[model samples]
Target chain A: MNIWLLIVGVGLVSLCLRASFLVLLRGRQLPERVTSSLGLVPAAVLAALIAPELLYSSVTGTLDVLNPRLVIGLLAAAVAWRTRNVLWTLMVGLGLLLVAQGLGWR
Target chain B: MRHPEDMTEIIPHSPQFRPAFWRGMRAFTPLVPGVVPFSMVAGIAAVQAGFTPAESIAFSLIGYAGSAQLIASQMVTSHAPTVLIVLSSLIVNLRFAMYSASLLPLFVGVPLPRRWLLAYGLTDQAYAVTMGRPVTEPSPAAYYAGAAALMWLTWQSGTAVGALVGAKIPSTWPLDFAVPLSFIALLVPVLQRRPQVFAAIVSAVVAVAAHGLPFRLNLILGAVCGVAVGQLMQRWQAKSV
Candidate 1:
């Protein structure tokens, strides 16, 4: 239960996972299908993280359309689609959220 | 095969240290804006969550992943058991395992010691840039080192600044939006194919459905489900083609 122990344990597990393929597939070429499938990891994981944050107000909590975070997040998504730039998308989302707040939308 | 000594000697050096460093900096240029706000917010959150400046900097340097650090800090604040916190954090970061696997092929020929460094430096930004790159003569170690080092330095500095100045910055600014915005931007570019889109949509839905699950187990489940679906879709497409 010690925090240091926990950190060390997690760190070791992460390292092992990271090193798994390197050790197992050392001299072998991964099949093309397997290689292509690895691309799913990021999108899958990111969506998993982002979804609840945008859709729900709290953990295990009710969905609230009035949630400012969700509204602002949608604005951010729109910006991401339009500009396709992280910096610009962030700026526009933040700008819109602040504007909405100033207009008493929050 | 040629001698290892000869190979090392033959590898061309950059023209100068200044340019090499500048090139490294330029490689990081694309990521600065994204890294800055996220790190700054992380810094401020660390302080607000009661971490000392030194601790905040240490987390930025060592923890590396902003989301994981944030989750860990939240657990700490709520007095969650250490094991639970670490377990959840591990689950959240499990995707890095896949990333490292995908990149291992690229780093195969690099020396053991340098490869170790790249392993430590493997990050979201570094992985994003390096994947799909077609270098006529790939030096994965050097490229990864350049990108990771720059990201590490920038993230640490930004966290420090944010911890120092974030309190003075007003809450009126929508700084919180930056993190999600950053992810959205990263997401759009990667959604170029049907399988990826399918995976993303399914993952989002599963995550939302499983959001209430205890110990953040839903994240792991959602990720696995998504990967399975994407792989199935990939197989189907391949067969049809």
Candidate 2:
């Protein structure tokens, strides 16, 4: 496989994956069941991605329930829950993360 | 209890497209710091992997997928076969399909060229910011444009800078933290309904349990399970009601 073919192949795969339903499925009849289920895709994907990051330490390969990320994430979650402000939630979460890491809380 | 997704519920005046677009842009601003470093790293990595400046920029534009770019560049540098490189990158990017499917409802009404552009700019961060947006956002096309256009520019410039700058930048800064932080902010508001919560919990558990899955497929597994449960639960609740 030449490098150009590789690029074209991967590009085709990605474009198809991204554009398939996005462009093709427009005005298409989605089943009621599928629409309801698809709504959960964002929640499921986000949680699936977030959980392991917070709970399982990427650096240490250990699952620390008291991982500072988990604790501070919960704090961030609280801010998000109460204020529902994007800026606040990020400021609080990342501020604490930097602070904790800076203070040597591994 | 107002969710960020719900904040735009009542438009003070007549609905317009530009405001929603700017709102999407504003919502994505906080994540820009993180985006710069990640894209820079990929740019740097591509250069280190022997890609010319032009190829590096092309990688960012054509691949447009972050992890896939990183993985592909690394494989290319390691003298890996093109087939292996392509396969690995494809697997890394399988999630985009899910992103595409999820955006269908919001984007189906958008015109042709605009929809094509949106599809081009569908990164994970943009999707999270846009999908987490309120259904009543009036003009999702504008909101998505605002959010994704920034990402497209940031990514392209980041790659160019990193490629041209080339390995001089120290990567020690914990800039990577911002990506997950951005997601957490987006995730909290979606925890509104019981089914959504349940779906999240199931996904979280399975993601952790299957964290060891190869190609990081466990994320997909968890998503599928969570979506299935949420759908079933939604039906059950509707019946009960």
| Most accurate candidate by lDDT | 2
True-vs-predicted CA distance for residue A2, candidate 1, Å: 5.8
> What is the docking quality class of candidate 1?
medium
Tens digits of lDDT, candidate 1, A1-106: 2544544655555555555554434445657766676678778867776777677763245877677778878777877787766677777777877787788665
Tens-digit lDDT track for model 2 on A1-106? 3656666766777777677677766545557776577567667877886788789764697888877888887888788788766567667776898788899875
User: Per-prediction DockQ, in order?
Assistant: 0.51, 0.37
Off by over 4 Å in 2: A1-14, A81-91, B1-60, B63-118, B121-151, B154-172
Q: Which DockQ-derived CAPRI band holds candidate 2?
A: acceptable
**In model 2, how large is the Cα lDDT of residue A61?**
72
Evaluate all candidate structures by whole-model CA lDDT and list the values in order.
0.67, 0.74
Question: Which candidate has the highest TM-score of all?
Answer: 1
CA deviation > 4 Å runs, candidate 1: A1-37, A58-61, B1-25, B74-81, B91-95, B105-109, B131-140, B166-177
Candidate 2 global TM-score: 0.62
